[model samples]
Target chain A: MGIIDGKTICQVALVVKDLDKTVEEYAKLFGVPKPEAFRVPEESVAHTQFKGAPSKTRARLAVFDLGQVVLEITEPDEEPSSWKDFLEKNGDGIHHIAFMTDDRDAAVKYFEKNDMPVRHYGEYEGGNYTVFDSKEKLGTFVQVKYEPKK
Target chain B: MGIIDGKTICQVALVVKDLDKTVEEYAKLFGVPKPEAFRVPEESVAHTQFKGAPSKTRARLAVFDLGQVVLEITEPDEEPSSWKDFLEKNGDGIHHIAFMTDDRDAAVKYFEKNDMPVRHYGEYEGGNYTVFDSKEKLGTFVQVKYEPKK
Candidate 1:
């Protein structure tokens, strides 16, 4: 269990108020090619993966080339959406740092013992994800997104 | 000037509440080692760094082995503290994500051209930092932390 528990951070998603406007600014400011954006009717967010979270997010996102790494900006479409909530409560800021893992069950169990519970569970396309409410653990949300062959 | 501009993500720091408790939870839950914690008298907060902000905040923090690409947890020790204001306004959550560069002035200029102004600025043991009120740029704070020697 402990052996398969190691996790890698796949992508860091920043919740924005407007994805289109933000994407344009990033492309201009960062010299990053405009990233394709998607809409997740389920999550009520439009996102784009960094050549990564593409279809899964259906998420409206803008990708920026940050050296070798890719920066993904995700904006939620719903009014009371998670992105909006984070912006309203915290004011536009860093939202969640996502970690990719192979053994998600083990990862979730590891955190569960520590008093941090899985606040949200999601599965999209070939991806399985769980957001550990970092509020109880630290002060952020630790998102464990995994690829599960179903 | 524009040719030297590079896109990079250096660090993302979070304002956490209890260092000891948060550290313990991180180690046990994510299989992340107990981070070395320290008090930054100048920064006015107790924090750590991430070796990998997504995989681990191997924090180069104030003291101990408390560094990792960390989920930094900061508490207020005094007023006029940026970490404190972040906590009070946002309630323990992800604060800001910083991108490092060789030239600070150039990076600030790049953002300013996009209508984002440098809001807060600071210097630390590691390097010099500037906060772009990306609220106008991308609805978040894009921090530029640069190493002068580079």
Candidate 2:
């Protein structure tokens, strides 16, 4: 089996300049009610890390659950995070495709062994996620999210 | 209903520098055999049009069928197609997310009415497709492919 199951892709994320506008546009395009954009929780809650150190990286985020996969739109703050870096360098574009993993550490290790090291890591209410620098090989960053069973 | 059914996303396509390398890496990452890259057919067969005029834009393409959505990789020629333009301006990255549509022209008109015009149009063996300049609002190009009932 592959280190990461590509078939389990759960989300495709984009970094944008305007979170509200993009959310509205996507809602209109998809004929869904416009979902509100919410800010990522404070560092005390999210425990975000950039590179290898704790960082105050946060963003305004919105999601559209388009049945098969969730679409994520993020507008990052001026902090040193992967989202901010990608937005600054590539403008509004796809940032990463994320897959759900039962073992986030193992997935990260596999990617690291292949020379795609972690760029950012963070936690949310239900799960933690890691982004990898897989752009050189995959043409975009890859993310693995782990949410344990309740 | 939305003009285009976003839930029907059939493909997420990326523009890359090396089609073979990307395909191989993805195969390794997914634990699948590498799919061969094939050059897009000649204009006579593809009937390609860019910005409303007949054009000879082509690319080497490969795909990974990841169940819910197909992942497409393209290495465009130095032609004036949307793929080439995105590669030149943005380097290697996600180019478009495509939906399967029964009425491709109407979908194009819907996007055009919302100020997103067609960037490219082409036909293949069993279907045709249109690419739109939806990046201004949607943050990336959107495509609709139509294959008639067999």
* Top candidate when judged by lDDT against the true structure: 2
How accurate locally, in lDDT, is each candidate? 0.58, 0.88
Q: Which sections of candidate 1 miss by over 4 Å?
A: A1-7, A41-59, A65-69, A79-88, B1-7, B41-73, B113-115
Please give the TM-score that candidate 2 achieves against the real structure. Answer: 0.96
Instruction: Report the Cα lDDT for candidate 2.
Output: 0.88
DockQ of each: 0.34, 0.77
Which stretches in model 2 have alpha-carbon errors above 4 Å?
none
The stretch of ten residues in a row with the least summed lDDT in candidate 1 chain B is B48-57
- In candidate 2, what are the lDDT values of residues A1-150, reduced to their tens digit? 777777888888989999989998888888899877888878999999988888887788999886679899999998878999898898899999888898877888889999999999999999899999999989999899999899
- Name the 10 consecutive residues with the lowest summed lDDT in model 2 chain A: A1-10
- The lowest-lDDT stretch of 10 consecutive residues in candidate 1 chain A is A46-55
lDDT of 2 by residue, B52-145 (tens): 8887877899998876898999999977788888998998899998888988777877999999999889999999999999898999999999
lDDT (C-alpha) at residue B149 in model 1: 78
When candidate 2 is compared with the true two-chain complex, its DockQ is 0.77
The docking category that best describes candidate 1 is acceptable
